[model samples]
Target: MQSLVIPLLPELPGLVHASASGTVWAITATLLASAVATPVAGRLGDMYGKRRMLLASLGLLVVGSAVAGLSTTLIPLVVGRTLQGLSAGVIPLGISIMRDELPPERLGSATATMSSSLGVGGAVGLPTAALIADHASWHLLFWISAGLGVLATALVLRLVPESQARTGGRVDLVGAAGLSTVLVCLLLAISQGADWGWASGRTLGLSVVGVAVLVAWGRWELRARQPLVDLRTSARRQVLVTNLASVMFGVATMPVRLVQPQVLQLPTATGYGLGKSLLVTGLVLTPTGLVMMAVSPLSARISAARGPKTTLMAGAVVIAAGYGLGVGLMSAIWQLMMVTTVIGAGIGLAYGAMPALIMAAVPISETGAANSLNSLMRTVGAAIASAVGGAVLAGITITVAGATVPGQNGLRVAMVIGGAAALLALAITTFVPRRRPPASADA
Candidate 1:
């Protein structure tokens, strides 16, 4: 639902503009809320019970979707979307639960499937939302989301068991507050900096304050008995580098999302544009999600055979190849589909490997928090990708039918940048320790 709003914007600019701050908050609300919710929910899941928290998260999703579905105005939409954002913790929590409940040998494949669901949901949601938007009232989107959330909640309640892992201690309230503040400040600055002007006082001030708060937050975490994030475990070579690579992979994949839809939907009179409708555009990208789901088990097999580190590097290469293909292949729908599915394949392999890599390095007790932090790193990378892609597209624009749109050259530049990020991730993955360190409580 968060991502569905973006592609829907070009189709419903008027309806979005009718909202509180226009469509800006439509995307920002979810991004900011998710950034705040993921780590905090992870901590809560760690301290209490994972299944209980998972249920709570899905409940938020159901309520959020219902709220958005009923609203005709922007404020209500933003509020509902914020509620949906709170559910972002589900994936990481699910991964941690698998780590705890599944057999050691089964952990890799199970967690891989869980991790791939993140991409799968977004991939399927985009086109599915587009189809509904094209065929019915836009409000129906939320109603459908709510229904699915209800179904997911019921299935999880029936099929999944709560993990026995526990880190019994007081929830570090101060750390949670500090981390939330830092993330909100940093993401706000990044997401809005382009609009506010990158060098503007508001952007720079928030950036500085976020950094200052982060320093203090780190100090607080170091001293706390049960920190929201276990910095020591996070600092280990394998854990640290995997997190870094995850960020880069996030950065690389996000632009494909932002750029491709625009290229596909732009008017053909623009010479380079494919001139497809929003529904058609979504259909083109649908295969990418299907491929990710299909490739996830294969990704697990590769990780099992060669270790997750190899799987990650191979994913990075494939992602870079996809972006490289986009630099030339984006002119035709078939070419775009091929490019997106290939990128999806790479993301499937890389996302599947990340949890395995983190789990190997961190103690079982710390799995929820550790996985949450890794998830947060990817969120950070995605935030940066949105900011960078926005700036590039906004800077280079052409007037089509008296309205400004991003130039074809700008789209190519974005693809190239994405490829570079994939290569950077590949380089970082190389630094991850080849051997897993023994997991201990102290780590």
Candidate 2:
């Protein structure tokens, strides 16, 4: 769902009969909705039932996709995209459900696979959406998403068991509202700062208000009887460091998504550009998702034998190496593919380790909210990366046949930043406390 509309972005204004600026809301709406909804959905999942919330989320996806598929105007499309974003909590909820349903021996691999699905969907969605947009009416993109949503909903209803674990409590409406406001204010600013101007009052105002609300929200969460998020638990060494590293990993993983396509598709007249079609670009990047899936079992095994901390550190190192190689590898499609695949493997490893670390630190009852918070951290990191990468690319540009585009140096700088972020994650991961056996278990 994340990558579904990306390939079609250039044509969105015409398709929706709206200005480019207005149509941008379609993407922004999704980001805002996902940011606000993910944590709330997780909390609700823990309170109600993971399967029930998962079903509800999938239902939204189905309805949202259908709405988007049928839409011809901007408002309805934005609404549909927002609804699709509301389903972002499904991943963490799925991981939590696995904790409840799967045996300890199988849990690591199961969660790893579930976690890696995030990348897989994005990696695969690009080519699929690009192919659909090229050959068929673009509405088919949403229709197909709707169909897949329906199929997934049915399968989950029929096959997945409801989790027995529950954190029975009233919804913390105040906390939810506070967090939502903070996220909207901050994410909106970050996402739009480039268009709006970083120094613009709107951007600075939102950033200030977000931080202020966050401080108040933290205090409220610390006091609330049935808090939306357990700040105390989140403050634990393992969970805290894991989430911090998750943010850096989020930052680390985005450059490939942001820079590689442009590098691939920009006109070869620019000398450094590969000048590939969207279809070819998507195919070249597809190996990243494949490699991520392929690495899940290895990640899980490393986590099992050593610790999630070790796996996370190893993943960070691998990601840094990938980006370092990417700095000089942009001239050839094969080189870019190899770089992305390596980064994907690292992301798969890190992503899989995150849930394990969070679940291990928090009570099973808190898994949904905890995992969701971790997921939110990653989203925040990605937003930061997007903002930073956009600024860099926009700042350093070269005109190719009268059209301004990011220069090769800008792309290389972005890759370098990504590598730095990965190393920062590695440094953060070093602080994650090593796992110890349960007191009741024998050494």
Candidate 3:
């Protein structure tokens, strides 16, 4: 959505860099709150009530959307986004609720179906937002988001059943604090690296501090009765390798986010860019997500047939091929859409496999925490992509307004890097076993 209206940032009144920085800040706040909220909600659901938290979260999202739509300043917009970030937690909590309430055969599919909402949200958010922003007003985007949130809340309250998965573990506040610090530090480093230079003191200090905090948090979780994340159980070969592969896939395949905006945003002078409006760009990308949604069920089928490891490897290979094909196919906008669809298919396949791999490794009780960490890896990978991709873009200027002209050299570099990273992921995933051996908790 931000990408759609990115060129209009300079046009928003009294908002500093509304399209780029303001929107980035909005999503940054959303994702940061989500990083914490998802795990917290999952754990809380296991304790008090999942439905209670889920409904309450939906309320928060409504408030967030209204607040964002009404906001006149950047900071408040970010705060509003922070409130809406609870969407991240809702699905996880829903999964936990279903596991406790539903029968065994239905649990996995239900969890997967609910989790696919992420893709749905992304697919819907962008183009819808662009259309509203272009024709109706940018505020309408949040209004729609809030309205949908309200509807979902009502439906959940009315139809979705609650769970009684009671547990006695207390909130590990200190551990959560440590991990949040680590996330903040690492994310900040990635966000600021291109702008501040990788060698800068703030980057170096924060990176070191992040690592130190994570180390301390690991030790603490090992000893704590109520751990935020149990590293020991998470380190088993199946879980560990799955998590590692997720991080790689996350980092490797995110070039779409980087590529889509540049491809659409580039001026007409560039031979590559179609120079279509933001809405057109979003429309093109939207189908990729739709394709992802459709492929998710197929992905589940693949996981069932080929095993999660094979599905993962196949996803990686396909992703690499998608990127490779993209290199030769970027001459036109439709070609961009086709390549993205391929990439999205790969994502759907891998995402479907991730949970299966996780379940195969850990005790049922620890699934939420393990998956939360897996989610964290993805967020970290995306942050890195954002930083690196931004740097690549910033390095080469097309000079449309200046005397000296340049081509779309920077964007091409970034896209090729995306392909190369996918290749790297394919290589790594190949070593993952098919129907890998079960892992002991301590292993």
Candidate 4:
């Protein structure tokens, strides 16, 4: 829904005119809110109850969707979108819940599927959003989101059991406040840097503040009795290396999402463009999401047979191969689909392995916070990719019909960069400690 807002400009003239930044806020607001809410929700889930926090996240989604569906103005829409973003913790929370509730034998596949849900939702949701926006009223998108949220909430209530594992510590208010401050500043700078000018005072100011606050936040976390994150556990060699590789993986995987649509939708008059309609572009991309789902179990099987470290390295290599293919294969729609599916499979494998790797290093009580932090690392990586990739695309542009469009070489550069990131991830994963025994039942 957030990314969908960009193309929604024509359909939402009234709301756009009402706000200075227009529907762009509808997109950025969600990103910002998701970044902030995810980690906090994880910590809260660890302290109180995963099920309770999960339910609350779902409820926010339900309410947010309904509010956005009914809104006729920009303010209400942004408010609703922000609320929806608050529910971004659902993925990590679900993973943590699975860790607590599932037996070790079943854990690999279940967590893999749960973790892949994040990518699957975005991959599948984009085309669905575009299809609805084209054929039906834009308002219907949120209504459908609301309906799904309600159904998910009910299903979870009926089927999922609350875990007894609890990190019995007082909420670290100062740490939470500091962390939120850091994230908001950093993300705002990255997300808006293009528009504001990367060198502009606002962007530079936020960047500096974010770094300073992050340092302070780290200091506070190390000292707090019950920190928002278990810094020591997170600092473990296994956990630390997994997270570093995840950041690279995040950068490696994001180019498909950022590059494919633009290339597919550009006018064929450009010679290199496919000139597909939004729905068709979406359809071409749909296989990527399906491949992720299809590959999840196989990925889990690989992790079980070898180890998640092996799985992670394999996934990174596959992603690099996919990007290498993309550099040459993007001239045709079918070719692009193949490239995306290949990359998606890699992402599915890597994402599926991440939760297993993290859980194996942290205590059960720390699952929520640990998993959340890992998720946050991926978010940071993706944001950096967006910032850096956008700059690359913007750097080499040709004016088409008086509008700026990225030159073909720009897309190629993105592919090469993505491939490099994946290879870097692969290199980093090579150093991660070999498979340890599954985390102790009582740890």
Candidate 5:
């Protein structure tokens, strides 16, 4: 769902009969909704049932896709996207379910595979969405997504069993509201800072309000009987370091997504631009996803043998290496493809290990909320990367003919920053305690 509208972004203004700025809400709404929903859904999954929450999320996706498919205006599309975003908890919930249903011997590989799906979907979806947008009516994209959602819902109902593991507790409505407010305010500020003027009153006010609310929210969570998130668990050295590394990995992942497509599709008249079409750009990046999938088992094996910490550190090293290579090799499509593929492999290794680390630290009862918090940390990292990267790309630009575009220097700088982030992740992972045997779900 994340990549579904990216290919059509340039045309959305015309399609929705709105200004570009107005149509941007379609994208922003999804991010905001996902941020707010992920942890809340996870907590609900723990309290109710993972399968039940999973189904609920899928239902929302189906409804959202259908709404988006039928929309001719920005507001309805944004509403639809928000519903789709509510399904963001599915991945972490799936990971928690694996913890409940799968035996210890199979848990590592199963969770690894499930975790890697994030990259697989995005990488594969990009080309698929691009192809659909290129050949068919754009509405067909959402219709297809809705169909897939239905199929997935059916399959899950038929095959997946609801786990007996449950953390029976009342929902923390107050904590949920507090966290939602914090996320919305902070994300809005981060996401729109460039467009709204970073120093503007609106941006600063939101930032200040978000931080203030966060402090209050932290105190409330600590005092609540059934907190939305277990703050004490999250503050543990293992969980804390792992989440911080996840954030850096998130930052590392963003530049390739943002910079490569622009570099590929920029007019060739720009000295360094490849000038590939959108379809070609998507095809080039497809290998990255394939490589990530192929590396899942390897990630699991390394995590099993050397521990998730080692796997994470190795992945960070590989990602840093990929970005370092990217710095010197931006002129050719094959070079960019090679860079992305290497980075994807690194991501596959890192992503697969992260959940293992989190699960190992938290009890089975808290798996849903714990894993969701980890996912949210990554989301926060991506938001930061997007903001900083946009500033960099926009800050350094050159004119081609009558058009202003990001300069080659800006692309190189972004790659360097990506590499630095990866290295930072590696350094942080070094502080993560070595893995312990995972806690059994029934324990």
Candidate 6:
């Protein structure tokens, strides 16, 4: 939705013309809400019912999408987007269900395949939305999304089974509040920092508030019985390492997010960027989804044969190695394709193993919260990368044609940072000792 700002900005009439600050606020709210809400909903579903929660999530998305489709003003659009954000938890919730319901032998690979759906979702959404906005009414885009939501709601009713782990507990409202507050403040600071000077009161105030809230949240979790996030479980050597790696790996993964456009938009004179039209850009990048689709199951095989931990580490190393090579080779179109395929393959392998690691380290009952926290960390990492990546890109300027054009320097810097981040992920994956999970009570 936020990405729509560039193209949609020219289309909307008489709107206060959203500033970057406002846009950040909207995206921040949606991203943070989605990250926290998904796990909270997942845990709730585990205790009450996933089917009910899934339907509710889909409904919220429909309402949000419809509202966004009809929205003439920005506030209403933001409201709709926030509501839509609730759907982010669907994948994690779905993955957690496999753990609670599936047999051990079938669970690992199922978990891997389920997690890869994130990549698939993003890759699909970008192109679909791009095509609609480029060639058709943007309104049609949201309407179609709403229609899909309705269909998904119907499917969930017919297909998803209710979980039996219904346990009575007061909803962890206090814990939820604490965690949301921490995330909101920290992300606000990061998202708003560029517009507000880093040292200005807006940035400083949010940063201070964010830190204090997070610190307080930590202290509160230590004493809370049914914590929103189980910090202790999260701190386990295996869980802790995997999630720490996720944060860095997630951040590092954004180079493609940055580079894809550069590759497609760079002038043909440079002999790299296709210089294709907007629709063409989407079409060119379409191969990424197909490659990821193929890599995911293959990654699962590697995970199964080599152990999830080893698969994850090898994937991270391979990702960093690709970026390092890309620096020298990305000048050619085929080189760009090769680099993207390699990176996508690595992501498939790493993303597939992350959930397995988190599930292995925590109590089965806490999978919803744990996976959500991991999801939260992944977004936080990505958010931080986005903030810093923008700064890096802005600082480096390249000369092209008669005008001073931005060279690939920003991308190179970002990729190097990504490579370093991959190394960090490699370090984090090692502490998961590869010990076998104990036989289940059901097993």
- State each model's CA lDDT, in order: 0.88, 0.92, 0.71, 0.88, 0.93, 0.74
lDDT of 3 at 412: 67
Q: Ten consecutive residues with minimal summed lDDT in candidate 2?
A: 434-443
lDDT of 6 by residue, 1-443 (tens): 32433334345443435654465444665776786686688678666766667678888889988987887667877787788887777777787778878887788778877887777666566667677777887677678879999998888788777666544476778777877777777887786677677889988998898899889889988898777776887888888888889998888778767766676777877645567555555555555555666677767777678788988998898888878877776665677777777777778788888888888777666777678778777888988987887777667866668654446767778888888888888987787778667323232
- Identify the runs in model 5 with alpha carbons over 4 angstroms from their true place: 439-443
Q: Give per-residue CA lDDT, model 3, range 119-217, as digits (tens).
A: 666766677766776687677777887888889998997898866445556888998788778887888788877766899999999999999998998
How many clashes (backbone atoms < 3 Å, residues ≥3 apart in a chain or on different chains) does model 5 have?
0
Error of 2 at 306 (Å): 0.5
Give me the displacement of residue 118 in model 1, in angstroms: 1.2
Pitting candidate 1 against candidate 2, the one with the higher lDDT is 2
- lDDT of candidate 1? 0.88
lDDT of 5 by residue, 1-443 (tens): 88889899999999999999988888889999999999999999999999999999999999999999999998889999999999999999999999989998899999999989989898999999999999999999999999999999999999999988888989999999999999999999999999999999999999999999999999999999989998998998899999999999989999998899988999999998988888899988888778888898999999889999999999999999999999998889989999999999999999999999999988889999999999999998998999999999999999999999999999999999999999999999999987576666554
TM-score of each: 0.96, 0.98, 0.90, 0.97, 0.99, 0.92
Best candidate, TM-score-wise? 5
Backbone clash pairs for candidate 6 read 398-405, 398-407
TM match of model 6 to true structure: 0.92
Better-scoring candidate (lDDT), 4 or 5? 5
**In model 6, how large is the Cα lDDT of residue 267?**
83
Better of 1 and 4 by lDDT: 1
Residue runs of model 3 more than 4 Å from their true location after superposition: 1-10, 13-23, 101-104, 403-407, 430-433, 436-443
Rank the candidate models, highest lDDT first. 5, 2, 1, 4, 6, 3
Residues 340-378, model 4: lDDT tens digits: 989999999999999989998988888999899899889
